[model samples]
Target: MSVLDCGCGPGTITQGIAQIVAPGKVIGCDLEPGMVERAAALAEGANLDNLSFQVGNILDLPFEDNTFDAVLSCAVTEHLGEPVKAMSELGRVVKRGGVVGITRTDWAAHMIAPSCGAVNRFFELFESGFNLQGGTMNGGRNLPSMLGEAGLNVVDVLIALSGAYTPEPGNAMVNGWAEWIENLPLFDRVIEEGLTTRDELDAMCAEMREWGAQPGTIAATGGCRVVARKD
Candidate 1:
C-alpha cells in the first residue's frame, strides 16, 4: 500500500518504510527543502525506486485528499501549534480504512536522575522558551484525544519510557546527552530569548556531564505512539 512519512527528517525511518512496502510507493515529506534534498539523496543512494521525497508542511499538506493508503509521522506534532489540525490533514490524505501513526514526546514526563540544579535550571529555561515559541511540551500524552478530535478512530496508544544510564570510564550517556542537548536548537532558543546566557548554558551542560559521572545516573523521557484509522 502507498505510504506517506510526514516530517521525515533525513529519511532514516522513511528508508525503512520504503523497504517494508517495496513495489508500493512511499513518499517522504518535510517542511525544509534541505531535508527533502537529503532524503531524496539517501533514497537515491540506496537505489530504492519505490521511494520519493518532497517538501511539504504538516499543517498544510501538499497531497490531494485520500492520496495515501497510510501515513506515519514522528516527533513533529510537538512543534506544531495546531496539532489537531495537523492530524486532520493527515487523515484527509488517507484512504478510507487507512491508518495513521504518530509518535511524540511528553516533556512533562521526562526525568533525569541525579537531577542537578544546572539540569533543572536548563529545563526550566528550555521549556519556557519552547512554549513561548508556540510548541507543546506534552504533546505525546494528548495524541489519542487529538486524533479522536480530528475525526479518526483511535486504534491504539502505546506509552513507553526510554532512557540510558551513564556508564563509567567514558561517562557515555551523560556526556553524550550533554553534548547533544547543547547542540540542539532549543539551547540556542533559550539563549536567544534571554532566558539564560551562553556562559550559563555551557556551565549547565558541563554540570550535566559531571552529574552523569556520578554513580547511578539515568536520563529517561516519556514517549507515546498513537495509531488511528480514517474510517
Candidate 2:
C-alpha cells in the first residue's frame, strides 16, 4: 500500500511503519526541510527502499488527489495554524475507501506541573503566550469533528496509545529540557517574568524526576486514534 505519513518527524513512526511495509512504499512528509532531509538520510542509511521523505505541509500538500492508499498523521494537528482546513486537505488527497489514521497527545498537565504554585503560575504564563500568539493547538477532540466536516466517513474512533508519559528527570527528557533551556528565547522568557530562580527551577526539575519515577504519581495522557475512510 502507498502510505503518506504526514508530519513525519525525524522518521520516528515512519521508520517503524517502513519496516512493516517492507517492499511497499511510505512517504514521510513534513513542513520542516531539515526534518525531511534528516528522515531521508536515516532511511538511506538504513537502506530501506520502502521509505522516502518530502518537505511539504498538510495545509497544502504537493501530491495529486486520490494518490495514497492510506494517510496517517500523528502529533501534528495541534501544531497547525488551520487544523480544520488541514483535515479537509487530508481527505481531498486520499482515494475513496482509503484509511486515515490519526494519533494525539493532550498534554495539558505536562505543560504545567500540577504542584508547585510558583511553577504552575510560571507555566501558565508561558503557555498563555503560546496560545495567544501561536496559530493553533487544538488536540484530537476537535479533529474528529473536523474530520466529519471534511467529508470523510467515520469508520472507527479509538485510542492510539494511552499510557504513562511522565518524563523522568535526568533521563533523556530532562536532558532535552536542559539543552533547550539554554535557548535564548525560552530562557529569556522565564527570567523576564521572574517566575522562579534558576536554582529553584533546577530543584523543581529534580522533583519532576522524582515524581515521575514514583508509581501512581505520574499521570498518563489520553489520546484519540481515529480511523476514517474517504467516501
Clashes of each: 0, 1
Give candidate 1 regions above 4 Å deviation.
169-177, 214-216
* Residue lDDT tens for model 1, 1-231: 899999999999999999999989999999999999988887776878899999999999999999999999999988887889999999999999999999988867877776678766755775776687788666688889999999999999999887777555334755765775678887787777777788887887888877877877777778899899998
Ten residues in a row with the worst lDDT in model 1? 165-174
Query: How does residue 174 of candidate 2 score in lDDT?
Result: 33
Task: Please write out the lDDT profile of model 2 over residues 18-87, one tens digit for every residue.
Answer: 8888787889999999999988877767878888899988999999999988999987887556777888
TM-score against native, each model: 0.91, 0.77
Cand. 1 TM to true fold: 0.91
